[model samples]
Target: MTAPTREPANPRFHKEIVSFTRRGGRLTERQQDAWDDLASTYVLDIPRHTSSTSVDPEFQLDLTETFGREASTIMEIGSGRGEALVHAAHENPDINFLGLEVYIPGVAQALVTMRHLGVTNIRFAIVDAAAALATMLPAASLDELRIWFPDPWHKKRHHKRRLITDDFVPLAARVVKPNGVWRLATDWQEYADQMHEVLLSATGFEYSGVWDERFDDRPITRFEGKGIAAGREIRDLSARRINP
Candidate 1:
């Protein structure tokens, strides 16, 4: 299979290549309550984007200060409503989890669920996942990174906006510890194939091929359930960072 390729980042297309669209959906009353009450406690304060090329050092989250103790950290990119993150955090109290989602409602919903479940080991960030991986995280800081059911962007022209791209793989490798796993899932066949091809060609990662099943730590999200009902097959890809 030919390796998937991405267009070179140009100034004009920089923001257009972002993986997510800024969604404007009104939050439900409960979700608003969660945002009002729990945001200060669980939300991460990321530095504002001055330009796509540079991130302020002051904005980078200090892992020691954020988690209050050194622990294996797992980050979920685009953790929609937090089904997987919340469950994983609750199940593994020893592991600290951070979720990055640009959708405001999704972030609020995740916070609400975490609050109700009394989960303390997880935090949510309203930031661009690719940018966060590129600038906010320290090198060799992450134990695991998960990208689940990200937007397929099925149309040809929109494929550049997909989260798993040629450039993103190297950024991910830089942040993830040696042997750290990067797990991804998508219900779209084309996107899955692209993910496989891209990761296979990327340096510092060993592609294990498609996983036989969903990760044991991940729960069956509502979105995945809907995809299953629609007869879409879920595809999983796992890669381990190999070069230190």
Candidate 2:
């Protein structure tokens, strides 16, 4: 395969390849109620430069103000329905959690979970996470980053669209503080292997070159349960950011 191209400076209007695709759907009754009751508190209103998922280049989140206190922040990429995110936030009240997603229905579903769980340490953003990492977040500002079960983009020709690529690793490295840990998991063997390869050689990062055990804090969401029932082995890996 040819070398992967650098993402344009403005990822909002990026060319063909992207880590995620936006999804839309009507919210359910519970979801609507959650949105009505909790969205103002839990969902961040990010200014868009081009589209709904776009984060304005100058728009950096004031997370301390957003969360109402200074705390260690953890960001979960593609936090579908926030099942595991809210669970983790509930378990760790001292830490702040951010769930990044582009799907409106899923964001509302996450709000539904937030209402049921009554967790305040967690918040949700509808911006393109990869773009947020590229320009919106402060350098070395995050304590941890999690990406669980990102779409595998199964076909060989479409692997370029996978989120854990060589080009994407640097953005992750840029945002995570020195010694900050990046935890990722996937059930797709090929995608897991590719993530392993890309992360092992990633600059400003250090890895054991071995798969880590499953993170105990990560709850088994319905999505993960389905992967298990389908007889797929879940691979978990963690890497530490190395300061320059």
Candidate 3:
């Protein structure tokens, strides 16, 4: 396999977070324990960014534990900065939200927002959404999955890294129950077309009606703000998992 080419775009448009495994990574035992304790104690289910095996087994929830709950569960993959998660959690207190974003700084910022707002219904993990569906979630467990404004990777060589590809959609279908919603938003036109094609081609899923600002009044994300500043058009695609 060839190496994925790195594109230097507007720094603000992309995440500034570094991975936890990077060299010179330092976290005090208390901080680590806090992360673990919060993960374990939070009754509302949240995904974990790290491998659960290294942690105490009591904190972990298996398929039965995850699926046994009757609450409407929503997992927003690529939940950068978690603004949507916090907003959704605040607006709809009845639904349980699980957000997964791979950036530590973003997670910290989101946590601060959650604390300031006193939003208790949402939980977070820092993990790649593409990889998490197969491993972390059980079949037909989720009610809705959101992937909004993911990295377009506009360069031709980096297209494979786009989250809406063939490989990831089926895994999404597997995790979401029948008729569950998969909401995707993108500012890049080509990437939006790619998302449409790939999602429509994927079995067990069907593309629903297209939406605009009038239809869904979602807050403008940081990345989308940049796109708007550059006079880019934002497109949203809503698809449903028809077959479990």
Candidate 4:
């Protein structure tokens, strides 16, 4: 499959924008053990950018080989602590789940949880979500894309740092198969509005508005719980790819 052409950065947002900041934290013993033993098995190694031209084919991830068989694939970006991903993998053993997370401790924590639960359908990669989408993932290969409770970047100046942006919408649309769903959730009202607007305006996607029911299968992570306790409304948006 031919990779989709990445769009130019929107002039509305910051020219040099990043969705996440790398933070340092100490890992628990279990996490460290899992990271050391399971990382080679679960974490993908993506090559750094080598040229200014196009993404190198050598760095592309082979989904069929990664999962050991062909199956429906769901990718969750910013899978913090991996509560939702682990639960989804356990519940849907036939479907392959891949998580992209930049935080080291969160990746380690997820590895430990997966080991304890004996889940085999999930894998992870330590990489920027946009970069991976643009370079590594195969075109029209993903069945679903989930972005739950991504960093809001509340400050006006930092809003450009938010993950859901004008440029990212088309990138997501390019990777998802026709009729595949893109699911998103955020507690911040402003961010939710931005997400809705971006998704609606993006070509090849049809906005379905908010989800009718709570995603009960997705466990409420600590961040989500905090948002609930603070009386923040949890907004969900789902869209389907309408163009190939």
Candidate 5:
């Protein structure tokens, strides 16, 4: 459960460790079309602090007002391409879903999926997940938090950039309600070990002792496909926040 002491040099204004890199790439035809037509509807217009992906700490995100209801809420961290989020939103229309993704193309693609499937219960934000967890969201707001197929940061030196860490565990616990579940999936053994090692002793959460089964509803993404193609075992883990 050792936390890495490494952090990026001079992050302009904040000292918080960032997880994902901002990838700049031209969108595909479908992604561009979806972005043009549906972004205003599905993407949030939240205030930013430092960078475009940075969240404004003082900006309050009222889930009830945004989703137009106060039903059970699920926030998916790093919701790449939105297959699972869209599927769950379509399957259970009563629940409100907010997907946190930094990549534009993935978020655009997610909008494409939602549009094509005619799903309306999901919304997205292009904010840093750490900042969202640390500041923007209300405490005990989410019923479930899902982190699927996060980049494992396989290199020993780059492990500090991995999303699940000692510092991140509390930020996650801060947002999830008491008894709320945090579900995570990965295709790297060492990273999976690191996740369990960190969460096992985390202050506000309790880890399930053994590895959990695959989340059947989650559709295989391109990342997961590559992992499977490389013969890596996909591991799913779950933890529950202790009631305050």
Candidate 6:
């Protein structure tokens, strides 16, 4: 699980790592239309707010101090609707969370949810999680990371669009601290198998277990509910970083 001694030097490393083939992808015409329209609705400048020196007044305590153990920062990839981030932040008040999602409405919805729930420990950005991970997250800064119910892109020709792949896992491994956990869930059994293979082959991860039963802290996501209703089997994979 040793970290890669060097990162790719190309300016496109971020883009290359996560970019997917758009042609023949799983998105329907309607979904594409909605995504285009919704993506444009984003009004906030994410890079501005996240980089600003002014901290949000809602944060009740500095993360290091409140956690007592001094290390409890977590970032969730593809945080849709913000339900999981909001719930996790509310339940574990000591941890600080940053959620990344690309959809405009989803970002706004998550912000509103954070405000309504009166939780101060979470922040969000509208961006592709993989690009953000490479450039935004500090190396070795995350304790836990989750990618739940990401787009399955079920068609064989569209498999390249799926996020969990050999190219991106090394970047995740870089950001996660030693012994940190990474969780991924998907109801698509074929895609789940693909993830298992890709992650197990990645350089910096140690696949701990694959579970048929939900672990204690893994919440049944709204997506998981829809999956269950459709009689799809929920698949979960747990892995840890074995080197700093």
RMSD of each: 6.9, 6.3, 8.2, 6.3, 5.7, 10.2
* C-alpha lDDT score of every prediction, in listed order: 0.81, 0.84, 0.64, 0.82, 0.85, 0.65
Q: Is candidate 1 or candidate 3 better by lDDT?
A: 1
Write down the RMSD of candidate 1 (Cα, Å): 6.9
Please count the clashing residue pairs in each candidate, in the order shown. Answer: 0, 0, 0, 0, 0, 0
lDDT of 2: 0.84
lDDT of 5 by residue, 1-244 (tens): 1111222445673455567666666789988888888887789988878777777788989998998878999999998888789988999899999999887778889888898999999989888898899899999999999999888877888888999998888898889999999999999989889888987888899887789999887889787888999999999999999997
lDDT of 5: 0.85
Looking at model 3, residue 108 earns an lDDT score of: 49
Report model 2's TM-score to 2 decimal places.
0.92
Q: RMSD of model 4, in Å?
A: 6.3
Q: How close is candidate 6 to the true structure, as a TM-score?
A: 0.72
TM-score result, candidate 5:
0.92
Off by over 4 Å in 6: 1-71
Please report, as a residue range, the 10-residue window in candidate 5 with the lowest summed lDDT: 1-10
Candidate 6 structure quality by residue, lDDT tens digits, 172-237: 987889989888889999888988888778678888546645645656777888999999998888
Q: Pick by lDDT: which candidate is best?
A: 5
Return whichever of 1 and 2 wins on lDDT. Answer: 2
* Candidate 4 global lDDT: 0.82
Over 1-244, each residue of candidate 3 has an lDDT whose tens digit, in order, gives: 1111222343542342321221112334543444444444332343333332112223333533443445788888767777877788888777788887655445545665676677767766544454457666667878988888888888897776666787777788888899898888888999988888887687888775345342253678798888899999888887788864
Residue 42 lDDT in candidate 1: 82
Of 1 and 4, the candidate ranking higher by TM-score? 1
